[model samples]
Target: MGQRVLFIGLNYAPEHTGIAPYTSGMAQSLAAAGWDVGVVTGLPHYPQWQVHAGYERGHQNRDIINGVPVERVPHPVPGNAGLARRLGMEIMFGLRAARARWNNPDAVVVVSPALFASVIVRLRAKYHGIPVLAWVQDIYTAGLTETGSAGGFATRAMRAVEGRFLRSCEGMVVIHDRFAQYVQRVLGVDPARVHTVRNWTHIGPSTHMDPATLRERFGWPMEDIIVLHTGNMGAKQDLGNVAAAAARADQSGAPVRFVLVGGGRQRPLLEELAAHAPRFEVLPSVDDETYSALLGAADVLLVNERPGLTEMCVPSKLTSYFTAGRPVLAAVEAQSPSAFEVASADAGMRVPPGDPRALLAGALTLHGQWVESGGTRHSGGARYVREVLSRDAATKAFIAALNAVRTKGHAPTRTTTIATLNN
Candidate 1:
């Protein structure tokens, strides 16, 4: 029988937010790459925290999407979830999950952030006597620590479980250097068994709309300097500071406009923070055409994070930012994985995390530079995204590593590691 891989994750499409796009993409691409790939995911519901309109909590759904078999199990979707409620939800998923609805003959790749699902995936692979890989999209405990999502006891318990699941895997794939360091030192995964697979822009190429025309269409002033951030406005994002920076810029009489786009549970908090700041605009997400237009229309693409959010998931928005051909102003920690990615890609400038003054100053400086250079494109990020960090590049590297794991009956060796990075 041909080698088969089963992917387990809580979030998957047709949910439009968070990690769904990437997980769905990976499963489909792996199938296209000639592996027998099947996905076990929860029913579609994500940042909204409610099952999408077509799905019911008690019913199961199955479909073949892009040649990948997907079995969607029903689980409670809490309107507002804390650690306890989230765990209860995972318990429901475990109760409802039948054996992965596929003839899996080889391996499994489990994604996190329905992190409690790890126990089920690990045990299932062990029972089947097949290899398993933990695809560490987010360093679980570190993220909870940064977000203050759980109490100390819960953090420790989650970490212990995560470590056991990771170490039990035949291999692990981490997306960032800081994640790799944390996992190796704290989680005790063998450095040899850990692999780093950098993410690419999951969304397609931008429409490359004319900046002036697009800005005018959106009712934005042609002369003002625009800084736009589009993505989930969760606690870890610290986007309240964007409103703060907008207030600062307005008080200083600078022609700077800050636009925060996208929806999440934190959107209400963001709206409250920006209520008095006229220059700060929090818009409900627009259509894809407008999204592509906004990326091209802005003078700068901005990223902000809460202080003490040192290393967690590398924000997926950076990959999208890199594709827009605009300079990025990253108001993030010096040691954050996002900071590393910005510098490594040579994409844009960085400031200390959660500092509104610095964020304001950085945006103005970037605006001035754009004016000074007569808008000569600072297109390093676009070039890097296309040539170095394209989706095809990530796919090629992952397949090679998967092939190695199948051949060796374990994680790829150092040789495969070097080659994958080169891809």
Candidate 2:
């Protein structure tokens, strides 16, 4: 048999969440690269913890997505904010994934944010004598702590556990360079063991939609300027500033209208605030077609991450925004690596995070500049995504890392030294 690769992820398609796209894209890419690929995942029930409309409950439901075998195993669907229930879900899925591997022993990759799942993969790797690659989308404990979600003794214990489990992986894939550095400096992981594989936008049909069609569909005034923010609206987003900016822009008699899309814990509150502002519109969660069309309707894309969260998280939406070819008006920490990327690409401007006045000022400045130069928001970053961040490029990098691990004939070593950042 050719080299078989197994991918373990918390979310997979038919799930409609952020992780699903990445997991599905990576699986397809690996399959296209000639590796026999299998995905072990929990039953589809993310964002809404109920089995998707049609999938039956099961222990080993197998299906083919883009020619790769996907095995869906049963796991609990914990409601949001129940620690015990959430941990139970992770443990159940982990056990099922580990058991599934016994029948198909192969090199494995584990995606994280499910802390218990990482532990399970480590144990399974050791038991099966298979190599393990830990794909670190976010620094677990640090993310919780930075977002104020974990605290006191709980945070300490979780950190200790997370550090140990992360160090056990045969290889680690990180999305940000700062995270790689933090992992090396804090966890003593060797730099070489960690590979920086930034997230990419999987090219899809209809990425570009006609602006007039989008405007007509949304009932937007033909001459009004639209500034859109799309993605999960959670505590980490700090959207009050976005509202304040909208109010400020409106007061100044600017034609700019703000559109907020997607749903999360903070959606209700954002809706309440937006209702009081005539220039702002809060849209219900939309299906992919409508979502992409909405994005295409924008004059500017607004990205806001909570203040002080730069190193703790990276918004995956940036890739999509860039691919959509819209000028970005990002409100994030000045020091954030994401800010650097936006600035370096000359896509748009970045203001200090959580500063409504500054956000308003920056938006106005960009609007003025766009009008003065008679230039529609245009940037070469979409070309960058096509050339560097496409699914094919991500697959090549992923396979190279996997091959390196397999060739060493031993568990991969870790290195802490920083490398040049890839755009």
Candidate 3:
């Protein structure tokens, strides 16, 4: 616990979904595993896209959560974020978050959402003669292009910015194997310095949640088969397919009910789709215990990604889905890293991304299997995740990367500005 581990991110706990949970989990797990952890992040505002009460343009503050120290910097809450709006918010966070000086850490891990914050981390770590690890959750340049935000020249410029800071970092961690490849091959980073650290489920254990109580609360009949998707309803999630699937399932007189629980700009679109579907329901985000309970009570957990998002990220919700002990139905790109991960886990089925028919068929297949087995699909998800993809495994890998970079030595100190961020 002697060495200090600093995590810099725009997202953190109380945000509930997306990279926030993982960032919080990583810092807490690292602390539990005998590292003194610290985090510098912005005020919590996500999923709902509004700042949580009590922290409106709040000044920078410090507190400890689960034995790890956290310093939060205040910034404007960017609701229903567009690329330009998000960029402005992240820039504000990067400047303010970097202003807080703590005792020199042995290493710093920078999380993306504010990807350019890596520059702040790299320069700060260099000043202290420590290593910097870029914990990449998304490839922003490709994300922009895939999401139709930027074009040829803008994409090239963004890529150059990404490449510069990534190459400058002492080490890097990507959440999926494909990400590692992109970092090394596309970003031109040293493959030897890039490591794959898969994200783990964020939902707590289902023990405290009584399935009967939860089902009763939701007013779902025992005969109803629940198919649920839980997480941020962001644009990258091709969730329109889910609503369309729900409508198809309802028309066919299936007893299955589709439930979507979370927040984001796309939520309204999903809600509108749900409205005409006889059995479709959309619930706002719930408390941690209730969320876990919902996961457990669900007969099938769904992972639906919009087309082209495969190049951006692997949905982190799959981890929680696997841990829920329910069979998963991942409607993602056939060759996506998510599809590959689910294939390896043996807990789910993958259909092509953005296909309503495929998503409906997969859900029906899982439902039929469950009914035939007397409601016992006997998921392999829990076991697979426990042995192969636990957060503890990620903690170990992160520590190993830190050690590797520390042993390799740090770059000489120098201020790196965004002007020089483009390689």
Q: In terms of lDDT, which candidate is strongest? A: 3
Give the CA lDDT, 0 to 100, for residue 399 in model 2: 81
Task: Put the candidates in lDDT order, highest first.
Answer: 3, 1, 2
What does candidate 1's lDDT look like per residue over 181-256, in tens digits?
9999999998988887778786555555777887887778988889999888778888878888999988999999
Better of 2 and 3 by TM-score: 3
Error of 2 at 354 (Å): 1.3
For residues 216-311, what per-residue lDDT tens digits would candidate 2 score against the true structure?
Answer: 887789777788887777777888778988898788887778888876667778899887998888886567666666666787788888888767
Q: Evaluate model 3: give its lDDT.
A: 0.80
- Point out the higher-scoring one by lDDT: 2 or 3: 3
Once fitted onto the true fold, the runs of candidate 2 whose alpha carbons sit more than 4 angstroms away are 47-51, 56-60, 82-85, 203-209, 250-252, 376-378, 407-423
Q: Summarize candidate 3's per-residue lDDT along 58-107 as a digit string, tens digits.
A: 57778887788888988877776887778778777887766676456667
Where does candidate 3 clash, by residue pair? 238-306
| CA lDDT, candidate 1, residue 101 | 53
